[model samples]
Target chain A: MSTDSVTVHGYSTSGNCHKVRLVLEQVGRPYQWIEVDSPNGATRTAAYLAKNPNGKVPMLERADGAVLTESNAIICWLAEGTPMMPTDAWQRAQALSWLFFEQYSHEPYVAVARFVRGWTPIDSPRRADLPRLIERGEQALAVMERHLGRHKWFTGPGYGVADVALFAYTHCAADGGFDLGKFPAVEGWLARVGRTPHFVPMPLPHDDVRTLLAQH
Target chain B: MSTDSVTVHGYSTSGNCHKVRLVLEQVGRPYQWIEVDSPNGATRTAAYLAKNPNGKVPMLERADGAVLTESNAIICWLAEGTPMMPTDAWQRAQALSWLFFEQYSHEPYVAVARFVRGWTPIDSPRRADLPRLIERGEQALAVMERHLGRHKWFTGPGYGVADVALFAYTHCAADGGFDLGKFPAVEGWLARVGRTPHFVPMPLPHDDVRTLLAQH
Candidate 1:
C-alpha cells in the first residue's frame, strides 16, 4: 500500500472510464492514465483479458498489479475514508441504493439508449430498435426526475459516488437522441453536480467536448 | 436507531423479495413479512408507491416509517455493521463491484429473461423479444463463469452480500430456460452458498420450506 502510483486502463471517450478519472481528481490522488483503445479491440487481448476476463474498459491497476474493474467499484474504493463516502450505515446504503439504481434502472436505458441513438445513425440497420430504447430511456429519466424533484443529490444532502455514477452518462444523454428538456428535475440536478469542484465532463474526443461545453 | 422491529413488504415467489428474507433469516434478525402481489398490481397502489416510486417489491419498512427499496440495497443496509460487510475498503468495494455486476451485467439478463420465459407462456407476445434477451443472458453468464473460474466468491474469500445478491435469482434461473449445467463453476458456487447456515430453499405457496428442509 506504500506505492503512490495508480494506473487506469480505459478510453478517455468512455463515460464509465471518466468516472474513475473524475474521482481520482476529486480526491487529489496522483495516477497515470493509460488510454486503452476499446474500439480497436485492445481489451480483448489475452494480456488485458487476464487482468479482467470481462474485457471492459475502466480497469484500475493498483501499484501491486492487483487489478480492479467496474467503474463505480473503483471510484468507491478510492473515495473510501474520505468525505465522499458517508460514514453512517444507512447513508452508505442509500448511496449503494443509487449506485444500484444507476445500473438497474438508469444505465440499461440511458446508456444503452444513447448508444442506439448516437452511435448508430438514423439510417443504420439498427434503427428498428430505437423506439423501444427511447420509450424505456424516457421511463428511466422520469424515475430520476421524480427523485431529484425532492433531493439535491441521489444519496443524501451532499454529493457522493451515487452522483458521480449517474452523472457520467446522463449529462451527455441528449447526444444519444433523447430530449433532455423533458426531464426538468434531472436537468437541474445535472447542473448542480456540474457546479461541484473537480467535476470533469465525460470523456469524449477533445474537440467534441470543447464544442459541447461551449454550448453550456 | 434503537428500534429493532423490521418489516419487509414482498411476495414469496419473487427472487428479489426472497433475497431480503434470506438475509434477514441468515442474520438472525427478527422481522415481519408483508406480502405484495405483483400479479394483481398491488405494488402500484398509491400506498405502496409512496414507499417506492419504482413500485418494486422487497421494500424494508424500518420501525420509524422510513422505507428502503431495491433488494440489493436493502440487504446491504441490513447487513451493515454485521459480519457480512467487509471492514477493509478494497474488499468492500469488491463486494459492491459484484453487486453492480449482478444488477447490470447479470440481473438484467437472467432476471428479465426469467420474467419473460417463466411468467409468460411460450407463445406470449413477449416471446418476440426472447432472442435478444437470451443473447445478452448467455453473455452475462459467460462473464460470471469466467470470474467464478478464478475466485471462490465474488468479493472476499468468504461468502458475503455479493454472493447473496447473485445467488437469489441465479439459482432459480433455470426456470427462465437457462441451462445451469453448462456453467460448472456457477454450479459449484450454488452448492457452496447452499451450505451456509440458515440457508433456505426457494419458497412456493404453502410449500413448507422448513418441513422440506427437515426431509432433506
Candidate 2:
C-alpha cells in the first residue's frame, strides 16, 4: 500500500464491488480490500451499518475516514483528473448518462438476474423472475449493442469509468443465463474492455456459489 | 428560450423527468419543454428510439442535435458550475452517491408504487408488487431519515443536485402510500427543498390517473 492508499470494503465476487478494484488497479492507485460477505448478513452488522447506513458494498474510505458509497460514484471519484474520466464537459455528460443507465436499466436486471440464478436455491421463488429479468436485461444489452455499433466507448473515445461500470456485470452476464452471443456488438465491446491496460478480471465465486451455479 | 437553450423531452408527471425541469428552473437556464407521455408509449416510437435507445425520459437535446439521457445525469450536467453542484471533488462525490441511491434504492420502489397505484388499473396485476415496493421504499426512507438527522443536505453544506434528485420522488411518496410523518427529519428536508430558489412542484397527474389514485 502507498502512503495515500484508500481502503475498499466489498464482497469479492459481486460485480458492483469488483468495479472499484478494477478501476484502482487500472489507475495504478494503491488500496487495501476488506471482503464483506454481503449475502450472509455481513453488511447488516451494526459496525458496517454505522459506516454505511445504506448497508451495501463496495465502499471507499479515505485515510481521514470520509467515505464514499455507490460503485459508480466511487469509480467516478477515483477516475477524476485521469484519462479514465472525460474532461470535456459534453463527453463527461455522456459518460455520466451511461453510468446512470447502467444503474437504472442494466444492473438491476443483469446483475440481479445473475444473483437470483446463482445465489438463490433452485426452488427459490425469486428464480421465477428470471424470464422477466432476462427480457429487461436484453433491452439494456440491445441499447449497448446499438451504441457499440457506432462508438468504441461509453466514455467518449476511450475505455473509461462508464465502460468499467458496465463491464462489471456484462462480462459475467452468462451467469444470469443471458446469451451474449445474440448481441455481437456487446461481445466485441466486452473483449475490447478486457484488453484495456492494467485490466483485471473479477475473481471467481467461492465453492459454494460455484456449486450452486453448476447445479442450476 | 435563449440562443443556447436546450430542449427536454419528458413526461410531465414523472418524478425522474420532473428532476430535470426542477434543476433547470432553479438554475434559471433557458430550456424548451416537450411533454412526453411515457407510460402511453410515446417514448417507444421509432423516432424517439432513434434518439435514445433506452427509450426513457427526460432526454436533454442540445441545439446541435446532441442528446443526453438519464434523469439524474441530466440534473448533474445542468447544475454543473452552478451553486447547485459542489465544486469540491469530495463534495461532488457525495452528491453523486445520493443521486445513485435515489435511482437504484428509492425511485424503483417509491416512484413505481405511485405508478402502480395511480397509472395502472385498480385490478392490474402490478398492484400485487405494491406491498414489496412499499417495504423497500420505506427502507430507503429510513436511510434518508438517518442521514438528514446529521446533515442538512445530501450534497455537502448546501441544497444541490442530490437534494433535487431525492425530492423528486420523496415529496410525492404519499402517492405511493409512504407516510412521511414517520420520518420527521426527511420531512423537514423536503420542506427546505421546497423553499429553494425557483423550485417548482411536479405537475399534477391528469384526471385519469388522479381518479385511479383516489379509487385506490
Candidate 1 is scored at a TM of 0.90
Task: Say which docking band candidate 1 falls in.
Answer: medium
lDDT of 1 at A129: 68
**Whose TM-score is greatest here?**
2
> TM-score of candidate 2 restricted to chain B?
0.97
Off by more than 4 A, model 1: A1-3, A206-216, B1-3, B205-216
**Taking the tens digit of each residue's C-alpha lDDT, what string does model 1 give over A5-105?**
79999888777888888888888889999989785689999988888877788999888888888898898888887777788888887887878777777
Please report, in order, the local distance difference test score of every candidate based on alpha carbons: 0.79, 0.92
How many backbone clashes can be found in candidate 2?
Answer: 0
The estimated TM-scores of all candidates read: 0.90, 0.98
B1-216: candidate 2 lDDT, tens digit per residue: 133799999999999999999988888989999998899999999999999989899999999999999998888888888899999988999999999999999999999999999999889999999999999999999999999888999888998999999999999999888889999999999999999889899989999888888875
**Where does candidate 2 stray beyond 4 Å?**
A1-3, B1-3
- Listed per prediction, chain B TM-scores read 0.90, 0.97
